[model samples]
Target: MGDLNAKVGREYDGFQGTIGKFGIGVRNDNRRRLLELCGASGLSITNTYFNHKLEHKTTWVSPNGLVQNLIDYVIVNQKWKKSILDTRTFRGCRRVPSDHKLVISKIRIKIQANQEKRRTIKFDVDNLRNERVKQQYEVKVGGKFAALIGMENMDMDSEESWAILSSDTKDVATEVLGYKRINSKPWFSDEAKVLSEEQQRLRVQVDDKQDLEKKQQLKRRRNRKLRELSDRMKHDQNMFWKERATKVAVAMEIGESRAMFAAVRFLRNASQEKVWRGVHGMLDEDGNLVTDEMEKRNLFARYFERLLNVDTTRYWDKKKKKSIADLNEALEVQEEDISAKR
Candidate 1:
């Protein structure tokens, strides 16, 4: 839940399934948009569905205390509408000092655990670049193959023979090159974390203080701590990126294409993972939500199969023929020029 600032008032006329009659304030353009989005996505505004007091419903207030609106909301899928027990705003929370009150929702869900665990085996293949490791691996693998060849007289099927070969190769590789080690480092330093905690403490103190002067003083210190924390985070982030860039540059300079590409791919996959985390599921042709991984893969495969096999023969008319002829003519001329230069 967040400060959406969309005043979805108590009008449930056409959006009966998306909103409820208990919402506060007058409806605005943003409210209409939010309603339409929720309706289309099969989501319900949990904050509006539950009945609560005015103080518990309103999430934001003006500085002069003249205007109060229920702008923040907790939205959930209509399929899980019964799972959300309650939704309301907590105005008495002094831990965070903000004009917007804390909007929270209590949800009950049962998660099933997978019984089978899939483990991927990764070898230190990068070490194979070393001459000593390469020679050792080759010798071990060659000896295993020789032993397998000596077992040719046995009554073994093709599958068993193939399995034996594969197992022996893996055993040799494991003995020669070890497993790859993964090392993860945090981005922020201890100083930044300390400053963040101090800022939070000051905020709570400012909210609890009775005297205006003391509250103002606490607020100033909190703001200073916030600035310091922000600067420290920026410094840490820059240093992290700087180190990554240095590794990429060194790999490129040394002609290590594998290492350079691996670094680039890691950065790309990290960004893709961050973007994919927000995507919950996809809708099928019947407008039903598909959450299963295998089903989603099948849906994508079917969609692309139909899209890529479209009948485009009608578009291959005189203009396309002329374009192809021109391209071939240019290629012939280039081939002739190359021959002349040679």
Candidate 2:
């Protein structure tokens, strides 16, 4: 999970369960400590379990590029050891400027169903402005109310009467007004979308190209497409905002508060949507990107559980307790001597 700077080497020996035979280099003091920790905690060094090329196995390299070492590791509990599908270093990554390669692990775990979100019911009450729909709703509700009046002698409770009225009203509204459908328009136009797709295609081509000349050519094309896509997006965004501003201005000029507020709400929701999409997923403790909703929820739950329920037994052991007691006794003697002098 981190760069522990431990050279475990290829020896498993007594630490068979904790260390794997695929490790590189010779064991060191740090390696011994790491092995001991893993053995005591019932964890397995996942990086050493999978066999890969030497380039993929090495995590850190010397500045002179003469030496390479596997210092970073991904450790997991023995119970979930089988979940580690693959673990290796990605040397092709250029996002970070460091001698250490990006260590990544592919893990597969069972995901439980997330709780269904509650949906708010919204009727198209604006449709009631239509005379025909309003008349139909009124007629249906009036007929139901008349029927309920005929049952006045049946000795119904106040709760029963209210429930019947509420049900009838909802049924009438459902049949007449119907539900509102929310459809959000995208800010980018079709041409921008095409350019974006082209840029992505070129990017994939660039990554897959092994020939230096071809790869450089593809990268240049990708960059060109990227710039074009960016310009198109900016233009579309500006047009979208201008249109929204015009709509809001017109609504205000007409003194239509509902239209003005609706435009404002749309802008707010669009911004919120962009923010939500940007942060739809997050990196886990292992620096792995997690996108599954259930996994994200579980990660947050575990984080808070650990944060609120900290175990201080390791720091407040018998040795530390005795040391603190001795310090307190010395302080008390010094205080007694000072008081006697006073």
Candidate 3:
């Protein structure tokens, strides 16, 4: 068997005409582009199916409705430029055992080698007359007088006349007639051309300037927001410290919370010589501020140090200083007395 060599093209399913064609693949857009480039319009249809394996004989079938549909597509769309004359179907083309037939379409697409075109030329001037000349030029009275054509009779339609008419190109009557009067038109002035370019250039410059200004505004907004946040952080820190100090002072007055915080702050607020420490309670019969006597028995229990100024431990030492000094001096005197007595 010989290969037909025709490239596999656009495929369709559900119809029976193209099923047995070899090399048919569902994936290929080249066939679609080729059909489009062929000036194809309307619908050129086909239908096909094949077995997954080669053991089964190939089958092709073209039903009457399918053929009519293709024809209808061609007719409705007025494409193809050729007619589909007839279609043939082979019941399992020779040795095939498939139930469907092999279908072939006889199309009238072939054309004569020499296509036709209009080939006539004549001299007539009505298609080339002006609006005013329409009623007059229709008379065509020029036999021999010739009238020295353009002195005062002819229309003022050259570059010199057009330039003298107006500097603005907008004022010119080119569009109403047809194409530009390039041959008889005044040259564009270098100054006007330069001005036009500058106008566009200025537009670009303005856009860039606006963009730059927007960026600067954005940067300023970001910086302002950041500064506001920073200020808020500082204010929050101050508020935290202030509230903590106030809570400690209130606790000391009512014994509602620990006195350690108030003691520390009292030390901080005190003058260098004044310190506050320990728990401050009402004076006993002896007229001294008292505290829990055991845990507070350290030097801290002896004196009232300024809360804001006192580092807890240091203030505690100052509070108990007299007791500590007396103890040391008493021990020293005892030792000396013992030696003398000896």
Candidate 4:
């Protein structure tokens, strides 16, 4: 995403399929080059598709607070555009300390971890600093290790002993201290969760109603929900950063570089893009190219089926086969995280 500072504006006209109709203001001259670039690259302007509050539509606001424009955008390949659930400028974001508002887009994609190998769980090591927690962990680990050592008659090699010790330690740590998933995104609070559900309900009402006034009322309620969510997210983010800053400051004062670095990394907000192992064209056993997407997808499915050796005898009749098109089609549906639920 970049601040293009070019307004493609309200007129889609010839570029209807390339851009959405929800853009703000009139198209500037720069839009010609923008459109040309997008057309050549098969990219679509993602921000224009979603309907949001005016506060969210405007990415740049004047210092005097009078002028606001949608000069920034997030673009994605035309084929992958459906993966984008929502795109909007968040005016609530103030952590960046910038003139331009934060542009956020939520996209749904899957990244699979290797299932053949058992990956060790990363336990919350910092929790061991607490005296009670440290004692609990020590007790658990000591008990597990004692049990393993009790088998005096068992003959074990050095590798086996090391593996057992490592596994037992990890298991004990997980059981006692629990695990923390690495995440940097701002988390919504309970208030935001409730408001999101209310907004979803309001959206359904707006879609189902035929009366203009009722629909308008639902729209108003949804708008109010959006505002509340924004405020709530802003508050949550502010609190998180404030606490984080305090921790980092303390760490620095105490000369704990590791803690300071960890805090800094957490606040850095790393960019993670979903990398697809795309199948351009696959060759069958006969050395012929399988050019169709559906065929390529089936080839992958068959290959994995053989690799995993899934028993097809029982469920073959009832199981429905899926194509790449089906997966792409599913991406068209609007998506939300668990926080949107009641």
Q: How well does each candidate superpose onto the true structure, as a TM-score?
A: 0.34, 0.37, 0.18, 0.41
Winner on TM-score between 2 and 4 is 4
- Cα displacement (Å) at residue 311, model 2: 68
What would the per-residue lDDT of candidate 4 be over residues 165-244, giving only the tens digit for each residue? 99999888778888977544545567877988988988998999999998998899899989988777666655554576
Ranking by TM-score: 4, 2, 1, 3
Q: Candidate 1 vs candidate 2: which has greater lDDT?
A: 2
Better of 1 and 4 by lDDT: 1
Candidate 1's C-alpha lDDT?
A: 0.83
User: Which model scores highest in lDDT?
Assistant: 2
Better candidate number, 1 or 2, judged by TM-score: 2
**lDDT per residue (tens digit) for residues 91-157 in model 1:** 8895876888888889899788878978787999989999999999999999999999999999999
Ranking by lDDT: 2, 1, 4, 3
What TM-score does candidate 3 reach? 0.18
